[model samples]
Target: MDLPNTEAVGAIVALLLARTKRGDGMKPWVRLVVPLCIAVAWVHSPALAQQPAKDPRIGFLWSGVAEAAAVRMNAFLEGVRGALRAQGDHIELVARIADGNQARLPTLAAELVAGKVDVLFAAGPAAVRAARAASPSVPIVALDLETDPIEAGLIAGLSHPGGNLTGVFFDFPDFGAKWLQLLRDAAPKLSRLAVFWDPSTGPMQLKAVEAVAGSMDVHLSVIEVIDVGNIEEAFRTAAKQKVDGLLVLSSPIFGSSPAMIADLALRDRLPAIMLFPEFAQTGGLLAYGPNLIDLFRQSGTMTGKVLAGTAPADLPVERPARFQLIVNLRTARTLGLDIPPSLLIRADQVIE
Candidate 1:
C-alpha cells in the first residue's frame, strides 16, 4: 500500500491524542473539524496564491501613417525595448496611425485604453492630447513634439508632468530662430519666405522667426495648413506672393505628409527648410531641427521607467540633447542653388 503523508498523519494524530487527554473538556467534533481546517488552509497557502507577472502593454498613437514616420518611430520604440530587455522586462507594443487625420486620434486613444494598455506612447501633440483625454491613470510618454507641452497645457510642467504624462520636448521656440538663419545662409538672396504652420501648435511661433528674419533682411508671411490637402495651395500662395523660400514648421498636419511636401517643394523650385531630417531625406533642400531619432529614443527611456514602476509624474520631461543641420546637395544641385560655404561647413549631414 502507498504510504500515507507522514506529516499530515502525524498532525492529525497529535490533535486526536490531545483531545483524548482533555476528555470531556473539549467537544469530540473539535478533533474532526480543526484538523481538516488546518489541512485546507495549508493547501491554499500564500505561495500558491502568487502568480507570475504579465508582460506590459505599450500603445502608440501617431498623427500620420506608421510607414511615413517609421524611421523615427522605430528608433524610439526599439530604444525602449532594448532598455527593457536588459532588465528582463518584456512588453507588447501596439501602434496606431492617424494618417494625417486628427479626428481619428481620440477614438484610437480610446481603443488603446480599452484594450488595457499599461502606458500610451504618443507621437505628436495631437496624439498626446487624445491619450491624456482617454485614460487618466495610464502613463503616457509624448515623443518628438515641436510645441511646449506645459505652455500648451498638455502637462502641468516639464519637471512634474502631474497627470500620468511626461516626455521629450523638441524646444521649437528656440529652434525657430536657428531654422530661419539657416535658410538665409542657404539662400542669401532670400528676402521674403512663406511659413507653413499649424496654429493649434500654440499661438504663432512667429516671435522667434520675426526676430531672426528682421535682422537678416528677410520678410515672413504665415500660412495655416490644418489639412494636408491644402499643402499645395499653401506653397502656391507663397509662390504667388513671390516668396523666395519656404519654412515649414513641424506640426501634426505637416509632419504627416513629408513625401508630398518634399515633392511639392521640389517641383516648385522652392528652397525649403523644414523641421526634421526626414524632409531633407525625402527631397527638401534643407532641414534644421532637433535630432528627432534621439527624442524618440529618450521617449523609449521614459516608457521603460514607467514600466519599471516609476510614476510618470516623478520622471521629468527631457529635451533633445542634440540638433542636426541636414543639407541635401543633390536637391541643391537640382534646384540650381549653390550651397553656401557656411551652410556646407555647418551641416551635420549632407545627403548627396
Candidate 2:
C-alpha cells in the first residue's frame, strides 16, 4: 500500500488533537491511540516511499549493414532475453550500425555513449575500438573475429579482464593457417594463390597466410579490398594474375557480403576459401571458421551479466565455442577442381 502524503497525515493528527482538547467524554484509550497514530504516520511518511527502477539500456555498435547482420543480431537478442528472463528485467537496445562504412563507427559509438547507455555491445574490432574510445567507464562486451585482445592491449588478461571490456575474440593468426591447408587439401595442384585482404581488419591473417604459403610452395598475389565497392575489382585483379585459387581473409566488409564474394569466385571460376561458413554455403568452394551467430549470442549473454551488476573486470574473455567447416561440391565442380575425399569427410556440412 502507498504511504499517506505529509499533508494527509498532518490533517489526521490535527483532527485527533482537536477531539482530545474538546474532552467530550473521550476514553483514556482514545488519548493513548493519538500518540500511536502519530508514530505510525511518521513511520509511513511519503519521504521513504520506494521509487521504481529504470530499465537498463544496452548500446549496440555494429560495423556491418543491418540487413547482413540481421541473423546475428537476432541471435544476440535471443541470448540477452534468455539471460534476463529469470530476473524479469526489461532491456532496451540502442543500436548504431555503420552500414559497411568503417569511418562512421567512432561517431556512432560516441552517439550511443552520449545517449547514456548502461552497457555497450560492440561487434568487430573496429566497432570495439570505437566504443572503448568513446567511453572509458562504460562496460563493453565485444564480438571480434580478427583481433587478439591481449596483443591489441584491449584488456589486461583473458582470465580476468581487469578493466571495463570483455568479449568473444578470435585468434585469427593461428586460425589463418588452417584455411590455407584446407584449400590445399581440396586443390592439391594449387600453385599460385590470390589473397583477398581487408587492411582495416589488421595484418594478422595476412601475415599468417604469408608465413605458410612459401612452405606449401605456393606463390601469392595479395589484393587489398578496402570496401564493398572494391570487391569486384579485387576478383578481376586475381583473375588477371592467373592465380590458381583465392583465399578471402576475414573482415567485416567481406564477412557482410558472403554471397557477393561467392558469386564472384564462381563467376571467375576461382576455387576460394574464406573464414565465414556462409561463404561456402552461398557458393564459395570452402569455409572454415568460428560460428559467428553463436559468438554473438555468447557476447550477448556476457552483456546480460554486466547488466545484472557483475563487473566487466570480473568477466573473463571468451572465444567462439563452436567452429565449422563447410564444403560446396557444386562450386568445386564448377571450377573443374576435385575436392579430396579426406577433406569432404572432415567437413561439418557438405553442399551438393
lDDT of each: 0.74, 0.81
lDDT of 2 by residue, 1-352 (tens): 6544443222121111121222433211101011111112233656675554666888888877656655766678767766675664445676767767778788879988998999999998889999999999999999888888889999999999999999888875877789999999998999999999888778999999999989999999999987778889998888889998999998888888999999988888888999888899999999999877788788888888888888989999988888899999998888888888888889999999
* Local accuracy of candidate 1 as per-residue lDDT tens digits, 50-72: 35356577887877644455565
Q: How close to the true structure is residue 82 of candidate 2, measured as C-alpha lDDT?
A: 62
Off by over 4 Å in 1: 1-52, 86-90
Q: Total clashing residue pairs per candidate? A: 0, 0
TM-score of predicted model 2? 0.84
TM-score of each: 0.79, 0.84
| lDDT measured at residue 111 in model 2 versus the true structure, 0 to 100 | 83
Model 1: weakest 10-residue lDDT segment is 27-36
Candidate 1 displacement at residue 227 in angstroms? 2.9
Report the number of the highest-lDDT candidate.
2
